[model samples]
Structure formats: C-alpha cells, structure tokens
Target: MKFQKPDFNPRIMPPKLKVLTLEVEKFDNNFAGVCYKNGRRYVIDGAIPGDVVKAAAVESFNNITYCGLLAVVKPSEKRVRPKCRYYDSCGGCDFMAVGLKDELAFKTDYVRRRLFPFGTEVRDAATEKGFRNKITLAFEKTNGKLNVGFIDDKTKKVTDVSECLMHEAVFSDLVKALRFWIEDNDVSIYVPRFGTGTLRFAVARYLDGQLLLTVVGTKSLPSTEDLYKKLKKRFPKVGLFENVNAEKTNEAVVGDVKHLYGEKFIESEMLGIKFRLGPDSFFQTNAAVCGKIYEDALEIVRGKNPSVVYDMYSGIGITSALFSRVAKKVVSVEIVKKAARAQKELLSENGISNVEVIEGDTEEALKNVAVEKGGVFFVDPPRRGLSGATEEILRFEPKAVLYLSCNPDTLVKDVEKFVAAGYKAVSATPYNMFRATTHVEIMVLLEKIENDE
Candidate 1:
C-alpha cells in the first residue's frame, strides 16, 4: 500500500475558514467581547456586549479562540454612535460606541470582579466629554504625506485622525494647525523603516488656559525658530519645547530638550494646590476626577489622625502637599531628581513646611523613615504596582495604607499580599478617571488587624 501510494501536495488544499454566529456576553478588560461556542470561549474584537455577530476564527490557543467581527447581525442596546470620525480606525477610545452609563457600569463591574470579596463603591467621572487635559499624537509618513493620529488596533497601522472626541476642542485646533504647518513647509516626516525624517510626536497639555506643546523629533529642525513664531502668534498662551530623540526607540520624549518659547513649565492648580508641570511630569489627565480622588484619600488619612504619613512614589509632591494639610508631618519619596526638586519648589511656593521631599527609591527611602505605630503610608505606585517596596511597607506595620492604583490586576495582587501580612481591606473604591478607555483607577484603604497570626 505504501509503494502504491500517489504523491499529494498539501499546498493544493485551501485552509478552511471557520465562521460562526456569536452572541457576545460581556466585555473583557481590553474591551473585547466575550462569547462562548461549542463549550469554548472566543474573544472577538469590535464586538460589544449583547451583540449578535458573524465572526471568523482568527486564531486559537488552548481552549480559547480569538475572532474578528465580520458582520453585526444584531446590535447591543447599549451601543451608540461614536462621536469621533476616526473611531473605526483610531485605537484611542475603546468604549466610544457604548453608552456612558453602560461604560461606567462595565468599568465598575470589571474592577469589582478583579477584587472579589472586597466591597467596592464606584464613582462616575466628573466630566464625561472633553475631559482629557493632555493629548499625545503620533506622526507617520503615508504616501509621502504626514499623517498625525493614533495607531490602528486591527492593522497596527497609523490611522489619520483629524479630531478626537475625548480631547478638548483646542487639541483638535492645534492638530489642524500643525498638520497645515507640516504640509505647507514640506517638513520631513519620520519614517522608521528608512531611518529618515525629522518629526516624530506632537504632545499638547492644557492647564489653566495655558498650553504646553512639545515637538519631538530626531534632530533640531531648521525651521523651528520660524515655526515657533507662527505657532505663538496663533496660540497666544502656548509654551513650546523641542525634544530630540535620536536613539531609534519608541519613546515619545528623550534626550536634549530645549525650551524654545514662553515659560519652562505650565502652572495648574488642583484642589487649591498649585502644580508646575514640565514635559516629563506625571499628572492625571482628568483634573476634576483627580481632585475627587485626592479628597477621598485625604478623608481616609484624616480619619486615622496619623502623626506621620509616607507618600511613596510621590511625583512633584502634590498629593504629599495635600496630605500635609491633614497629617502632622508628611514624608514624600520620589525617584526622579528633577521631580523631587520641583516638589521642593512647589512645597515652598505653597508654604507647606510639613512635607519633606526625599529623592530616592521607595524601598531604600523606607529604611530611613521612622515608622511610628499610628503612622499611615500613602502609596501611588506606577502601573507595575508595588515591587520590593510592598515588603518594606509591611515592615512598618503602619496604622493604615491608602493605595491608589491605575491597574486593577496589579492592585489586587498587591492587596492580596497586604492581606497575607495581617492587613484587612477596609474599602475599595473605583473611579472612572479615564473615560472612553479601558482604564480604571482604584483607591483601597487597608488597616492592620490587631492580634493577627
């Protein structure tokens, strides 16, 4: 039988396309729709909850499959028309098509599910539309023309977005002007493939009617001086900066920054506290929601009446300054030296003598802090969450820990570690800080249990 077998070519057969009708049950953390078929789960992008769609299996792994929505057989009741013209292509807003109420509910549910057995209270964003105070637009060369927009989700290509609904109207106006300037001047657009061109990213931050605009490129542009003049004339209260990043990396801001015009930093006030924001400073995008978060956190600290509060990963000491208003003494630990200097300046400007800024890593800075029994630790760690600092924080065995987190997964993990260390989770509150996006901010209050093994 083997000798008589005929030669066959596998390449002659076409791959079978598995298309199925899927009824989306809910949305996952990444805003992808979850559906079940044949006792296996499938995640389909571009499909909302309650959507009955025709989807094709794109890939399979283990017992799960990923799919692409081919057609919407039935749309969800929560679905609404997205405001932005580039919603289909732009990857900026994932829940733009869903109603605001539904979006908030989903975000709250998502956080609650991640932190199960912990009671959570959800708060909607103060401003649902035009809430973003900062916008960073990427530039790509397409057909010898400069396209400024976000990278597309499905194709991973740069999609030309003229306007974004989430950003302020001023942001769109600035983008229009920048696009015109690039086209009129025939400026070189950065193409990573060819390793040629100049401009890479345009970042605009709005605060207190002032705009801080940063033009990022590989090298200094020859027409920057002239362009700055034009831009200043157009936008009266604009601070222009040039950031040169020639390392061939994906970073937005890099080496050799020059303040071309206006002030070196933009001044903004949150909850009656003034903050000087530079090009690299970290500030929440939604000012009003951030104020709410700070108010809630301050309330938690006020209840404890801690003599000393340790603000870990304190950026520019805004929260630390706020803590100084309640706590007797506040110790702020930051990794960035420049930010620590800024924090010192801000504390002086605000006449806040209680907060002492320490420029070092949190894990090392904790060693020098005198951890009293009634002391409280307020940690606003990065998205990666607490690392070795978690152990250091527990070593203090403070009265309470107020942890603010942007990533719920890491937040839950850290909370579990705290629980294991004899700390009881008192309350977990989720805030809709980043609207229209799949991001949620959680503030958890943990108190040490007495006589725990």
Candidate 2:
C-alpha cells in the first residue's frame, strides 16, 4: 500500500466564538499556552507562558478547549517581540513569538516530562536567525492573485514571503523575484479544488555558497529559461530545476525532475564531513545544532568502546560516516538505493573504507548483517518510530541501543517497550535543532540490563 500525507487544504467555516480571560500557566508539548479558566483547560495560540490574555474559544473536544489569542491584556516579561515580520502569519517558525530563554526552559521540561525517571540533560541550543539551509515555498492564490510562501497553520493559505529570518537573505530575495515573475508572466497557480495551474511550488537550497533552485508546477513553463537568466545575473552560482507535480497530493516536490542550469547537486559540510545534497536529500535544516547532537552521540559511543557500530534506517549515512571515525567498522542500512549509493561515494571521496552500506529495509537487512556483542546500534526512524524493528534489535542484543527521535510521544512509548525487554534508559538529551519552537531532537541511550551478582 502506498503512503500519503494528509492534505493540508480544508474548507473552514466561521463558527460562533466564545470569549474568556485566562492566565497562561505553562507551555504544552506543542508550544501552545495552557491555561485554566473555571476548571476547564484551554490551549491558546499566540499567548506566551505566564501571560494574562483574552482568547476566543475556537472549539472543544474531549473536555479540553482550543482557542486563538484575542489580546494580551497583561503581557509577561519573558515574552519578547518577534524578530520576523512574518511571525504573525507564517507557520514556518512556531516559536517566533517566544523569547530564547523561555523556549529552552519549556523544551527541557517537555523532554523530561515524557522520559520521566530517566536523567535527562537538555543542551543549550539557542541559535540566531538565518540558520536554515533550505526553503520550499508553495505557489497558490490569495486575494484573487498569485502568492508564494509557507502555509498558515490555521488558514492553510500561502503567505507571501518577502523577508524570512529563518532562511538566508538570498532566499528571501529569490522569493521576491519568483513572486514577481509569476505576476508578470501571469503564471497560473495550483488550485486544489479545481486542480489546474502551471505553478505549484518553489524549492531553493543553499549550501557552501551555492544555490539550487527548483520550480514545481503542473508542467514546464515556457518562460523558465528567462527566469533562470534573471536569477543567474543576480546570483552567479545558481542552479535551476523543475519538478513536475501534477497529482493532487500533499507532497510539494515530486515527479520527474530536470536540471535547468548550473550544478545539479550542492556539497555541504556537516559535522566536519563534507557531503553532497540534491533537491530531495533528507538533510537537516539546522547544521550547527545537528553538529552538536552528532558530536554528543559520538562522545557517548567512545565511552562504550564498541568494536562495531550498526546504523539502522540511516538516511544518506551521515551518522554512519561520523561513527566510522571512532569504531573499527560501521554498517549503515538504508532503504533508498540512491541515498545508499551516494553514501558509498561520499565515503570514498574522503578515503574512508571501514564503513559498509547495505541497501535494504532496516528490519530485513538486520537479519542479514552480523553485529558483535560489544557493538552499539543507532536507530533514527521517522516520526512513527520503529514499528517491528524492536524485536530485531532485541534479537541482536547489542551492548547499547541509541534511539534518536524527533517526536517525544513515540520515543516514550518505544523506550517503555525496550525497558520491558530487559533494557534500561541510562540517559536522554534534548537538542534544540529547531530553535524558537517546541519541536526538538532527542537521543536516548538504552543499555542491556545484566543480572547482578
């Protein structure tokens, strides 16, 4: 069965809104302000922690109220003004309205709360603006005209982006050029209902001083060469590409891709290891914070003194490449053939030969690969976490299993499963990969529970 992401476009009707005044006590896992009004728990957006705000109840389900911020009657001292102009509309940065100090404090408790009873250490990952290496803007209709930017969390409409603090300044300028080109050339934007348009999305990635731009539309535009020539004049090192996405699906970048100009791939250095990135590469947006997480994981690996390392579900083999520096041999199992081949090429480029790339599903590949008893298994799965791979890892019974998760909800559940299987979570650390937001990267180390003498 093919997998599909939920379509973001949904028709919204105006509903009767109820008003209430509440004092926000703290932040929930989603970074929304949680307040109690007359014994009813309300989750309010745009209201910071420790704030007295008036909100309109949007709806209620399961005895919990969901609302939108009406006004901040009394603002909290910890609430700092947003730095990004698009903070009010753009859903790209969820925590733009929050101060750095408070953001970290909430993330710390957020991770510790889920992994209770385990000693959790949340690192300081406060980063500045323009930390993202990639940007994807969708082309849609707004106010009877074409616009491009991120989707609004509430409205699900494209917000025109002229300046974004999350991405490089060049990307913002490129967005302006693309929007103008769409308006000047009179390009048709994709309409989900009618399902007709020339343009659908614009993807741009910056790596090592070069830009890889891609235009996603129903079909190739006639004026694509002209747009490329314009971008080339402004930015010398730029590559333009096209991704034809005709299906009405949630995926922004899909279909057959063709290189329009310049280089086809961009090389970026991550964690002191240089690797190539394409339009569809699963690269981390924040390089600095990603480096911090990898470095910490390597330090933990060193203390284990493993003879070999097993990297399961390794995407592009970034962790495998880094783990190869210390361990005698590292095996990376990846399902994607393209990423597996690229990992081989990347390892060869750096003259590292101890790492082996196995192209197959992690669960199936785990049966074929042989792991030593003193080795560590590192698994970085998707948001769904390990499905049936739990039994596979238990069968291997490595010295330790390192689970890196993007969703804490799944992490807690998986950790309990391991605990029941004779494993104890030794330590959990949260990395603020996406700063100014509740989304975090956590690494939990689980060691086998040996019978005491």
Candidate 3:
C-alpha cells in the first residue's frame, strides 16, 4: 500500500458548478445583491433587489457563496438604462443601472439598518447628475500608449472615459483637453510597478466658476509650462499645480507641491460662509447635499448656545466659521498645517474673529484644550471614524456632540461608544451625497445625560 501511492493534480479536479436562477433578496451597501438559494446565501455582483438572475457559483467562503451573473431572468422594476456609456466598464458607479429613486431608498434603508431604533430622516441630493465638485482621474500606460480614465471592474484595466456623467460639463472639457495635451506632448505615464515614467494622476476641483487642477507626477516635467498654458486657455480661471509624489505607492497624491500658475487657492462660498480651498484640502464632493447636512448640524447646536465649540477634524474651517456665527468662540483642530493656515486666512478675510484655528493632531490638541462644561463638540472624522480620542473627547462632557460620518458602519460603532459614555443618540440623518454610488453621509446628534456624571 505504501508503494501504491498515485500522483494527483488538484487542478485536474475542479469543483462542479451549477447554474441556478436566484431571486435577489436585497442589495448591500456596496451594491452587491444578496440572494438565498436552498437555505444558503449568495452574493452576486451587478444584481439588484427583486431581480431573478441566472448565475453560477463562482466561489464559496465560509457560510456564504459568491456568484457571477450570467443573465437577468427577470429584471427588477427599478432597473434602468445607465446614462453614461462608460458605466458598463467603469468602476466609478455601481448603482447606475438602477433607478435613482430605488438607489436613494436602498441607501436610506441601509443607514436605518445600521443605526436601528434611531429615528432618521433621509435627504436626497438636489441633482442626481453632475453633482461632484471634484474628480480624480488616474493615468496608466497600456501597450506603449498613454491611457487616462477610471479603472474597469471586471477586466481591472483602465477604461478610456471621454466623459463622466457624475462631473460637470466643464470637467469633461478639461479631461479632453488634458488627454490631447498628453498625447501631443508625448507625456510619460507613471507605471508604479517599474517605478518609472512621470504623470500619475490628474485631479480637478471646480467651484464658483473656477477650477483648481493638480497634476501628480513622479518628477517635474519640462512640459508643465506648456501644459499650464493650454489648461489656462481652456479654463480661464484655473489654478495649476504640480504635486511631486516620488514614492512607489498606491496613493494618488502626496509630498511636495508647487504652484505653477494662477492663484494658489480657489475661493468658494457655502452656507453664506467663504472658504479658500487648496488643491489638497478636503471638501465635500456634493456641495448641495453637504450644505443641507451643515444646515442641519448648525440647527442642532444653535439652541445650545455653547460658550465654546470644538470643531474637530475641521478642514479649512468651514464648519468652524459656521459655528462662530452661533457660538461665542470656536476652536478648530486640524492636523494639516496648510489646511489650518488656509482656514485662518479665510476667517480673517471674512472678518470672523471668534474662531481660532489650531494646527495639530486632534487627539493631542484635545488634551491641551480647556474642557469647559456645556461646550459643544462638532466632529467630522474620516471614513474610518473616531480614533483613540473618542474617550478623551467624551471626558470633556460637552453639552452636545454632533458627528458627521461618511461610513455608517463606523458611525454606528462610534455611536455605541457615545451611548456607553452616557450620551443619547437623539437623531440620525442620512444624506445622499454621492449619487449613483453606494456611499452615503450621516449626521448624528448626541446629548449628554444630565445626571450621568
């Protein structure tokens, strides 16, 4: 028996695949449909809830399976033709095939599920199309030719998108102009694998009839002056910047930046407050939806009339300026020095003297700030949500805490912490900030219990 061992190859015996028709129960936050078959659940991409699709099991993991849609046996009533020609290949929009009404409903329901038992009001974006104020396009080299656009979902290749439906018309014009400029100048595209080439990403921010364009590259190119001239000609009120990102990493933009032409920052107004945005400053993409969120947040803290308000993670002090209008004094904490400096300039230009900008880490800065009782804390953390400073901020025992989150999962986790710290989640509101995408923004108001301390 020991000498009779036979050689076998695992590749020769593949798992049997069965094509089955499954009805999608619901769609998750990522736009992947959840379908149940024979008492087991399967996740199918490109399938919407209420759709019956013929799919084959692609892979199995743990208790659930993943399948690839073969054909739509019965399409959902919510299904619609995607407006953008690139929607089929481009990975930017997942819900494009679904109707906008259905998309909003799914997002609202997703938020409700995450923050169960908390009353919520869902607000849709004013306009579903052309709402993005900023767009970042990636550059790639394929077959010794320059390619620029979004990455495809299935092929994992760069899809040459002449226009994106989510961005304004001017953005499309700029993209076309930039692509032409690159081709005419024979610009070298950055290839991260080999750590060679030049241009990496083209990021454009449009606001108040002006544009801020940041070209990220591995090194400075001699053609920047000409490229700037071409862009300025097309976009009269354009600010051109070259961001040198020499590292071999996946980050789109980082490291030293130099202003090539026009103003270093573009001025934009939100909620009657002026803001100076730089190429790297973080501003909400959907201005209309963002304004509504801010208005609601302001309303929540207006009644408190706190003597001092802490605007944590304040980017260029938009929220801080808004708080200054209500609170006697507002302190903004931001780790980015340039952003903090811009905030200071914005406040001074607007004659807003009540707000003070602190350029330092939020956690460290919170420790030094005077924790006055009855103060209001307005936190707008990143997608990962609150860091280790959650407990430290709670120690202040602020009169109220308003949390603005882009990821509901993380928001719910942090809300649990706030609840344990004797704060009650009074209201949670979801905003459809990013249309045709699975992402959503939520604002939660937490009030401290009177006798918790």
Candidate 4:
C-alpha cells in the first residue's frame, strides 16, 4: 500500500460559511479535530477535545477540509490564554492557548484511545517534559528590511517572531543580531520576484545545552567569518554555521553548509552515550529534557532486552544508540545521506559497532529489511505520521513497537491501523518539546498479539 496523493483542492470550499455547532474530538498534526456536521467531516482549527464551538467551513486542500472557529459554545478545562502577544498572529505556537498540563493529558489520552482495541486494560501514563533537541527558524527580508519569524497558517504571511517561550532566552538576542547584521551590511534582500539576494533563513538547534545556528541565504555571505566571530564572542555556547540555498524557490533548506565557527559540528550526550551533529542533521531542539525521553524509552525496552531493534526514521541514530546498550543489535534507517554519514561516523568514532545506519526512506527501506521475530521496532517519523504502506509493513508483527511522535492525531490514526493488525498499545509518555506551542511529543509502547492466541 503506497502513499497516495490527495486529490481534493483546499480552495474548493466556500470562502465564508454559516457558523455551526462543531465538536472537536482530538488533535491531528498541526490541525485540530475532525468536526462532524450533517454527515460531513470538516477538519477544524482552534477547537480541542471536549470543546463545542460554532465553526465556519473554510478551505479544502489535498483531501483535508478546514474550518475556523467562529465562537466557542463550550470550552475544555485545558483552554487558556496564550502567553505570547504574537501567539495569535504567529502560527508557530498553536497549543499555547491551551494549558500545558492539560495538553500533555490530551496527548496521553490520544495514545490510550488508540490502544483501546488491544485489550480492556487501559491506564493513564505519566508524561515527561523539557526534552527538545531541535528547532528551525526562517529568515525573511522584505523591502531591504530583515525579519525572522514563522509563516501564518491562514494567510501564509511572515510575521516577525522574537520571543518564543519554547526557544531559549539567548535566541532572542541572536535574532536581533542577525537582523542588525543584514541592516548594517546593506545586503540586498532576496525577493521572490528577483530570485537572488542575501540571507534567507536562520535555523538553530540546541543539544545538551549547546546551540548550533545555521544561517541560510541565496548567495555567498561576505561577513560569514566576521559574523561567526562576533556571535562566538557574544555567546560562546552557540556554534555558528553558514549555508547557501542558491535555488530559486521558497524552500528554506540550504544546498551547501559551510563551517564558519566551531569545529564543523557539535556533540551532545544522552544517557552516557555521545552523538555528533552536523549543520543539517536532524535532532530535537530542547536540550535540557531529552534525558527523560531516553529514560522512558529505555524503560519500555527493559524486559525485551538482548533483542535486535529496528529504528525507523532514526535521525542521526541517536535513539538507535540509546536502544543499542540493552538490545543485542540496532539497525537505524535515515533517509538523508548526510545524516546517515554523520550517524556512521559518530557511531564508529564512539566505538559503537552494534548499530548499522542505513540511508534510505524508511517505508522503502523496510520493504527489503528482514524483520526477525521478537525484535523491537521503534519509529520516530515526521509530523505527517506513518504512511499506509509503512503501516502495512507492521504486518510482520514485531514483538513490540515503540512509536515516538510529535503529532498526536496522526499517532491516533496510526494506532488504529496497528490495532487493526492485532497489536496492543501498552503505555505512553508525553514529552514537552515545544513548551509554548500546541505541539507535543509522545513515546508509545505497543505489544504484538500472537495469531494463535
């Protein structure tokens, strides 16, 4: 079962619709609940579970129907006022309007709800916090003025974002410095109309309290060395890297990464295990709390030790090594070649020989890999969740499946597929990666049911 492209266009729906009583059932990726109305399902925003609201049907795109909240008829106990003034304007933080503790509870419930089909034994699991190891920020320059912010969900407009609670306090100053540098250098801003210019994006990730900033632009930076030097002097904790996009597109990723500061890359530790990260390597952003994630994940694999483990969507193979200590062997698959190289180098440098880093798409790679019976499987995929074909691969029925996700709604849907395949979700733990946003990360453990039983 390959992942099919959605056929529906999002702009086909009415521009404005009459408000109707819409009930939000659960969080799905960046969107809210799947609203039920008059035998039609409208994917709604700003409505949480247990909340009844008057919503206006809006756009439909790529098989997803969207609705906006017109009025809240009934609110959930989790609802709260967003702390940041930019929360409503900036689309980066959605769940900021909801209580932090309740958000965790909602994410936890979503996991338990998916496991309901496996057995009657359902329990509320404890969640962890403060463990984010990766974060990305876009750099936008309009009319020779530089701005660092996120894209608006509704209008797709870039709003300058400075103070995100989820980001470290030091990042605020970095944004200011980058803006000042652009202004000082009189560098031409990259315009979609012109298709060439200077700085375009600034992405930074924190691991083990160390920060790595990657500045992306359309052309070579003139003051890359100076900027790195100044930033290193200002904040010695941050390692700087410069990158060029060069491509004439809206994509934020860079084509080439240049080491401007530090030692070309940075290293972080988790549970006595060390891992090296390059400029573009995918890792979590919140540095202080990922230890809890490693601990909780290790607990899930406790009784199942001395087994081979397959780590799908394993970014840089950090989690792969986390499981390698207890497991007999760990094979981690990453789609990006650069990340796979980094994983291989890091593992080899650390003298870790039990793990194999395969570079290929997880769904495509899993098609060829042999899944030995009783081997533990861990998948930490992107927010889009598991593809239908990827779910079908679970038909091999590994002993236990530990799913780590940043989106709860997709987790629920994937859980449905797993339940259908006769697997039971045993426990889950939510970890707060984006503190001020609606996004949450969860680690779920599921056990496979024997066919004869």
* lDDT per residue as tens, model 3, 1-453: 111212212223235766679999997656688987677878887889889998777766666777777779898988898998887668689778887778777777777677765443444323333378998888887887666788675665678887778877786788777887798888888777788888888888998788988898888865777777788877878888989889867677887678898878788788888888888888889888888888888888898888999999998888898999888999899998888888898899888999878899888998898878789999999888997879879878898999999877788888899888888887777777888888778788888878834
**Candidate 2, position 347, lDDT:** 90
Which ranges in model 2 have alpha carbons more than 4 Å from their true place?
Answer: 1-15, 119-130
Clashes of 2: 0
lDDT of 1 by residue, 1-453 (tens): 111212212223225757789999988766789998788988887789999998777667777787766778999998888887787777678778887888788877777677666544444333334378888888887677667888775565688877777776676678777887787788788888888998888888887777888899888765766666666766777788989888878778886568887767888787778889987778888877888889889888988988899999999888999999888899899998888999999999999998888999999988887776668999999989998899989888898999999987788889989988888888777777888877788888889889947
Q: RMSD of model 1, in Å? A: 6.2
Off by over 4 Å in 1: 1-16, 118-130
| TM match of model 2 to true structure | 0.92
Between prediction 2 and prediction 3, the one with superior lDDT is: 3
* Per-model C-alpha RMSD: 6.2, 3.6, 5.7, 5.1
Residues forming the 10-long window of minimal summed lDDT in candidate 3: 1-10
Give lDDT for model 4.
Answer: 0.70
TM-score of 1: 0.92
User: Candidate 4: deviation at residue 376, Å?
Assistant: 2.2
Q: At residue 10, what lDDT does model 4 achieve?
A: 34
lDDT of 2 at 307: 80
Badly placed stretches (over 4 Å) of model 3 are 1-18, 117-130, 451-453
